[model samples]
Target: MNRYERTRVLVGGDPGVAQAIAAEIEEICEVEVLDAPREELVMVKVRESARNSLFYLGEALMCSCRVRIADAMGFGYVLGSKRNAAYNLALIDAAFSSGEEFERMPKWEERIEKEAKRQRDKRAKNRALIERTRVDFSTMDGDA
Candidate 1:
């Protein structure tokens, strides 16, 4: 998966995926925390539909961290104050960016792909359930 999809899965999927990857990475590589997990506020930007102009939606609290694995540097930023998740993401990022090859890389990627599939299935099921309850108001008489 690409970086965006990978991060989305890690952040939105089961938290255990990142933890497992981080654990494996720690066993082989020395993790150096360049920046500890810290909570901060970031301006949320959005586009104005009428004028097609950019504006700040608001400020959101985000947790971020930086780490180094061998010579490669990795950064993790996620919404909310999830310190552990942020740190675990940093480790996972470092593992992917580092030059060192991992024997378990294939397995890790498989797990992530599976999680992505599961999430997609869940959303589809939910949409189907909601669709079943949808009301066709146009077909109803005004008296009713």
Candidate 2:
């Protein structure tokens, strides 16, 4: 993934990642908040598989914030209720948007990939456990 992709995943996925990035940026440049963080119910969209028509899936809880540094405006929208983490994500976005160099992402790439694998493994394990409990009700009495 490129810088923006890496930033998106790191910021959106883990609050710790955002905080880590923010701390690194804070050491060098001043981060200014343009808009305070707030939580709201945001509409999520889904598409029809056949016709590709879009519709609202439902409202998802979101925390978002906007920040600025120099002349660049940065925005962060993340799932869940971590208001502070959202602000940190926005701050990291602002730092990158302002054309500052950050060297943390290389380290983050490894960490993020590891975390992703770990999550995938955990999910697969859970799925297998759930699958083992599955039984076909129609076949329980040998009814075809």
Best by TM-score: 1
lDDT of 1 at 19: 90
lDDT of 2 by residue, 1-144 (tens): 555675556754655766876777678677788779999899999998999899999899988899887887878777888788878777767776676555664664576576556666888999999999998887676654
Against the reference, the lDDT scores of all candidates come to 0.92, 0.74
lDDT of 2: 0.74
lDDT for 133 (candidate 1): 100
lDDT of 1 by residue, 1-144 (tens): 877889999999999988998888889889999999999999999999999999999999999999999899988999999999999999988888886778998888998999999999999999999999999989999985
Report the error of model 1 at residue 118, Å: 1.2
Name the weakest run of 10 consecutive residues (lDDT summed) in model 1: 92-101
Q: Give TM per candidate.
A: 0.91, 0.67
Lowest summed lDDT over 10 consecutive residues: which window, candidate 2?
Answer: 100-109
Off by over 4 Å in 1: 136-144
Error of 2 at 81 (Å): 1.0
